[model samples]
Target: MKVTSHRDEIRVSRLLGASRYRVEKPFLSEGVIYGFFGATLGLLISFLLSLYFQGPLNRFFDPVKFIESDPFFYLSVAALEIIGGILVGYFSSWLSVRRFIKF
Candidate 1:
């Protein structure tokens, strides 16, 4: 039942008039922003790599040019990944901070 430094900081913030929402919001928002940035970067790198390797891939597989021919499929997948990233980030941050803020 000993209060750790992390809990102390949360308690101090509450005592100093910061609302629970105010304290938790930043963590959630930061998680979301980071998730979005990470997902976008990952998607960009993957797309570029696929483009760069298209010739080798086509030569090896003979019918693997979906990247340029069916771009909407890739776009949909990218959208889903970004959305999933944002959701995971928000939930993880919320879960992590929920125990620290007593109120």
Candidate 2:
């Protein structure tokens, strides 16, 4: 899918005399950027939802309350999310590019 989307750009770059590394770098960087932003957005949404659940809504569900998460726990979870995103993005891009642009 990645290869299909970037096929034209990759071919154009090749035609324009771009070296393999030069052509690949931008795609890899793009993937990393996407992953970073995605993870950050996910974290933000989850945090917001947690806040909402912890508010007056707790009165309705008194028995099943939201646990107050520690700042450190949040930080650790965020770190893990970002790292996982980076790794997934890098590997996926690398695989797609490698398959499409065999050197």
Candidate 3:
């Protein structure tokens, strides 16, 4: 009985005309671009969904109107919008990188 090494086996298989496939390297730029695009799309989708929900949400909590009428309303809304945008951007970017990156 003879023991065959892994390399030897591969060589023998190739010699016997076995079909083999080569793996290609992934491009960094392509992945980066894809992630950027996906993140943008995700953010837009999230914003739209938020808007749709906000209509009903405001009705349920009319206090929002009162809050809006307050002097600080503008500042508060601005802060919220900024925070929401950052959150959406980060979440979308993360998902895109994790799900679409070949690496």
* Candidate 2 lDDT by residue in tens digits, 1-103: 7677888888898899999999889879878888888888888999899898876777878898567878899799899999898888888888888988875
Question: Model 2 Cα displacement at 42 (Å)?
Answer: 0.4
Off by over 4 Å in 2: 5-17, 56-69
TM-score of each: 0.78, 0.74, 0.38
Per-residue CA lDDT of model 3 for 7-90, tens digit only, reads 465456557766442111122334445555655566677768988998788789876545237748746765565556556555
**lDDT scores for all predictions?**
0.79, 0.85, 0.51
lDDT of 3 at 44: 70
The local lDDT score (0 to 100) that residue 75 gets in candidate 3 is 61
RMSD of each: 3.9, 3.0, 13.1
Full-model lDDT, candidate 1:
0.79
lDDT over C-alpha atoms for residue 103 of model 1: 74
> TM-score: which candidate is best?
1
**Reference-based TM-score, model 2:** 0.74
